[model samples]
Target: MDDCIIIGAGPAGLTAAIYLTRFHLSIRLFDCGSSRAALIPCTHNHAGYPAGVAGTELLRLMLEQAEKYGATREQAEVTAIVPVAGGFDVQIGDRTAKARTVLLATGVVNNRPDMDPAEHDAALQRGLLRYCPICDGYEVTDKRVGVIGTGDHGMREAIFLRGFTPDITLIAPGAAHELDDACRAKLDEAGIVHVDGPCTPIRIAGDRIAVETPAGPLTFDSIYPALGSVIRSKLAVAAGANASQDGCLEVDEHQRTSIPGLFAAGDVVKGLDQISHAMGEAGVAATTIRNLLAEQRPIRR
Candidate 1:
C-alpha cells in the first residue's frame, strides 16, 4: 500500500504530495479537474506574486513541483473512500487504491448566478462578474458594484465590499428582499441600496455588466453573486466522518479528522477559504501524517 492517498489536486493536495514525497513517502494524488482555485483568473492577494498569478499557472507550478519529487498523480475522481484494515480503499470507478492514510483537499463549488454559461464566463474573464471580494476587491475599488443576494449572507458580503467602494447595491436573487429588521438597519447605516430581484443578466458591454431588475435595468462595473457554495464533503461524511451542519469537515489543529487514518485540509475543513490558508493547512497535515506513520513504521533512506 502507498503511504498516503490524497484526493483533490488543488493547492492543498498538491502541497501535501510534495511534502510527503520529499519525505520519501509513497503517495497517490487524485484530481477531478473541478478545483475552485482553477477558476481564479488572477489573484493578487497570494503573497510573492507582485503582478498577481493566474490560478491555472499556480496549480501548474505546484503540480510540477510535486511531480519533481515523485508524487504520483491521477486525473480521476475518487468516488468513495472505505476504511480498510491498515488504511483506506480509495475507489475510482472500477479500480481501487489502498494507502495507509488518506487526505481530502476536495474543495467547495461556488453557486453561480442564473446567467448563460457563455455570458458568465465572458463577464468573469472581463472582470465584470466576480465572487470572493476578499480575493479581488481591489480590482473593483471605487467602482459601482452590484451584489446579487439577500439575507445575512448577502448583507455581510455587501458590508465587506463597502470598504472598497461606496456605490453598492444588494439585490435579492428571488423576487424580493428577505432582510429582517436588523439586516435592514445595518444596510441602511452602511448606505447600501437594497433592491428587489429575480434579476437576470441582460448584457455585458464594455467595462459594465447589465442586469435586469424589477426596479429596471441596472448596470455596474462588476456584479458579485453572494449565493453560498456546495461543500464537497460527501465522500468523507459517507465514510462515517463527522462534519458540521454546513457540511464542513471537523479537523483538529493537525488536520486530523474524526477518523483515525483519514485526514482533510483546504476549503473542505472550513476557515479562510484562501489558497494560502489551504496550503498552510496542507503543510501541517502532511507533517502530521509523516509523524503518525513513522510512529507505526520507521522511515529510512
Candidate 2:
C-alpha cells in the first residue's frame, strides 16, 4: 500500500504531494482535471507573481514541481474511498489502490450566472465577468460594477465590492429582490444601487456587460455573480467524514478530519478559499500525515 493517496491536483493536492514526496513517502495523486483554479484567466492576488499568472500556468508549474520530486499523478477520477484495516481502498472504476492515508483537495465549483456559455466565457476572458471580489476587486477599482445575486449573500458582496468601487448595483437573479430589511439598509448605507431582477439576456458590448432588469437595461464595467459555490466534499462525506451543512469538510488545526487517516484541505475544507490558504493547509496536512505515519511505522533515511 502506498503511504498516501491525494485526490484532486489543484494547488492544495500538488503542494501536499511535494511535501510528502520530499519526506520519502510513497504517494499517488489522482486528478479528474476539473480544478476551479484552472478556470482563472489570471490571478494577481497569489504572491510571487508581480505581473500575475494564469491559473492553468500556475497549476502546470506546481504539477511539474511535484513530479520532479517523484510524485506520481494519475489522470483518472476516484470513484470512492473505503476504509480498510490498515489504510483505505481508493476505487477508480474497476481498479482499486490501497493507501495508509488519504488527502482530499477537491475544491468548490462556482454557481455561474444564467448566460450563454460562449458569451460567458468571452466575458470572463475580457474581465467583464468575475466571481470572487477578494481575488480581483482591485482590478475594478473606481469602475462601475454589477453583482448578480440577492438577499444577504448579494448584499454582503455588494458591500465588499464597495471598497473597490463606489458605483455598485445589486441585481436579483430571480423575479425580484429577496433582501431583508436589514440587508436593504446595509446596501443603502453602502450607497449600492439595488435593482429587481429576473435579470436576463446578459450581453457583452464594447468593454461593458449589460444586464436586463425589471427596472430597465443596466450596464457595468464588470459583473460579479455573488451566488455561492458547491463545495466538492462528497467523497470524504460519503466515507463518514464530518462536513458542514454546505458540504465543506470539517478539519482540525492540523487538517485532520473526524475520520482517522483521512484529511482535507483547500476549498473542500471550511476556511478561506484562497490559493495561499489552501497551500498552507496542505503543508500542515502533509506534515501531520508524515508524523502520524512515522509513529505507525518508523521512518528512516
Task: List TM-score per model, in order.
Answer: 0.99, 0.99
What would the per-residue lDDT of candidate 2 be over residues 165-249, giving only the tens digit for each residue?
A: 9999999999879989999999989899999989999989887999988788999999999999999988998999998898999
In model 1, pairs of residues that clash are: none
- Candidate 2, poorest ten consecutive residues by summed lDDT: 205-214
The positional error of residue 162 in candidate 1, measured at the CA in angstroms, is 0.4
C-alpha root-mean-square deviation, each candidate: 0.8, 0.8
Each model's backbone clash number = 0, 0
**Alpha-carbon runs more than 4 Å astray in model 2:** none
**Deviation of model 2 at 31, angstroms:** 0.5
Error of 2 at 294 (Å): 0.2
The per-model lDDT (C-alpha) reads: 0.94, 0.94
